[model samples]
Target: MSDQQENKVVISLDDLLAQAQLLKKQIDDLSAARAELLDSVASIEAAKASIQELKTQQEMLVSSDKKGYLMFKINNQPPQKVLVYLGLSYYVEVDMDTALKILDERENELKEASTGLDKKLAESKAAYDQIVDILNQIQAQAQQKGE
Candidate 1:
């Protein structure tokens, strides 16, 4: 009894190979999907970082435009120059906002992909467990017949 408990149950090579082929294929597909999910996550993170940097730049441009407005009042600078600079700030802000939206969408897509991969992995594991159980049953029956 102790020997059986101490030693892990194992299947013969022929049975293991025959049953495991399908499970192995499923595992391989799940692994590939997981890798793609990770890649998507990395891309989303990088996009988020890029959006943050763009946000910082946009804020800086807005402050610069405000400074230009004050200088226009004090230095009597040309109105056209202030208007053009303000327009640049608006464009930068709008572009940064769009980038942030895309980053969020990508993050959501990654989340969905990860969930799908997790489900596939669980199903593959269940199938493998079933195969193992069958192998164990066959081995036990053989031992009993021998006795």
Candidate 2:
């Protein structure tokens, strides 16, 4: 092939700047999404910790004769609660067992969901960073052209 035909055409500065702006916006969007996921991860972590704490509390109750209960706080509002187990022979209480089972299932679901979201968020953030580097290189070349 001829030298002219073999070489790729160069992009204009104006076009480069425009593309940089678009890339910057994409980076910003990815950053925002990552922030939101971080919030979600925090929430999940808090929930996981709370669940573990509740389990500990439940175990404490099992060891004691008095029944134990759980308190829930939502939207910074009034607390809600549910009884965990009753006195004597902890296995005797079917209701408490069901409640524990449900909580366990829910915790597992939340953990899985958070993991998936975090993975996607990480991938998107990396992509955003790569685009930013490309934008910077293009802009740098464009600047060199004027000199």
Candidate 3:
């Protein structure tokens, strides 16, 4: 055998396929995580906009599936406080400014998490591509040997 052929590192086809499967799973999981993070960010933005709107609006429409929609009149007075969710089913009542700040912080955290997941997803996809390339090369080599 030539030196070039002797220096080749042989990897099992089955093992490569298994690794590709695992990488595909990882990519899917990362994509789901990133999607959740983005959803959280959007929720935060909506909350921030509602808070800002409440400062200027005196009347609002509230709705529930069981009660339908109700128009509430605030006597031309803005709300003094609002409840902010702090994860794990915990909520705190605070002034509008404080609530906005908390939401901003939470949005930032979610954005950071999404960004991290994006990086991991990219890496997993690259690994999956490399595995597929290796499998294709193996298939081509087997065909050549058979010929």
What are the per-model numbers of colliding residue pairs?
0, 0, 0
Candidates in order, TM-scores: namely 0.56, 0.44, 0.83
Better of 1 and 2 by lDDT: 1
Better of 2 and 3 by lDDT: 3
**What are the RMSDs of all candidates, in order?**
13.9, 11.1, 3.6
lDDT of 1 by residue, 1-147 (tens): 899888987767696868778897888889888988888678568656645654444332222252356322222321221111122355223355565665577678778889988998989888898887777888899999999
- Local accuracy of candidate 2 as per-residue lDDT tens digits, 53-124: 554453321222223354333333221343432327442223434655654565566567657756765765
Report the Cα lDDT for candidate 2: 0.55
Q: Which ten residues in a row have the lowest lDDT in candidate 2?
A: 59-68
Q: How far is candidate 2 from the true structure (C-alpha RMSD, Å)?
A: 11.1
- Candidate 3 C-alpha error for residue 103, in Å: 0.4
Deviation (Å) of 76 in candidate 2: 19
Error of 1 at 133 (Å): 1.4
Q: Pick the candidate with the highest lDDT.
A: 3
Q: Judged by lDDT against the true structure, how good is candidate 3? A: 0.86
